[model samples]
Target: MAIAELGPVVLDCPDPRALAGFYAEVLGATAEGDDEWTDLKVPGGRDLAFQAAPGFVPPKWPSAEHSQQFHLDLLVKDLDAAEEAVLALGAKVLDADDRSRSFRVYADPAGHPFCLCAC
Candidate 1:
């Protein structure tokens, strides 16, 4: 049988609870099940799973030294408000290029870069 569609995207983090909490807050979802592996469901039948790994390395973004394997793009109503909410939820603001009015880049607790777009 051929692969149907993409399943849940799993991410390795030093602490599943922390990473799960970040996404839970950002996506307005809750972490269900155990602490070792937390599943956070998203809208439109999408889901993200965060697993605990003893040796998890946070990615370095903006620097081309190590490539960023993957990133997520989220559409928001307000950029400033979304940025504030995410920052409060442990996402660090990497940089905001004034040239782009629609999107800005931010990193999660594990330093995985993601974009917040106003749409």
Candidate 2:
């Protein structure tokens, strides 16, 4: 018999609700579960879980040491609009590499860095 698979990604955050809310706003997903740990279900059955870690320390991206372990790259239809929307939702723009490349770096409310690339 074959074993069934589970959720693809499990993300740790200092505040599960905040993380879940951010993801839900970004991906149009719904946050599920209680206060401790929450699951954000994306399209096509892909799931991203946010577990609460009271002492979570967010990673610093593009650094020599203690860099971000993983970053979500989103292909945006309009980079400007996307950046504005995310920023309005509490994401902080880390760098605007418009002179170098097409993608711009941003950090979530919890300080997890991500990228928004023009599609």
lDDT of each residue in 1-119, candidate 2, tens digit only: 75986655877888888889998998889998777899888876578888888888888877868679898887788888898899999999889856358899999999889899887
> Candidate 2: misplaced stretches above 4 Å?
1-6
- What are the clashing pairs of model 1? none
Best by lDDT: 2
Give the alpha carbon lDDT tens digit for every residue of 32-56 in model 1.
7576888888766479998887777
* Lowest lDDT 10-residue stretch of candidate 2: 1-10
TM-score of each: 0.88, 0.87
Report, for every candidate in turn, its global Cα lDDT versus the true structure: 0.83, 0.85
**Candidate 1 residue-wise lDDT at 72:** 87
Colliding pairs, model 2: none
Off by over 4 Å in 1: 97-100
Cα error, residue 102 of model 1, in Å, equals 0.9
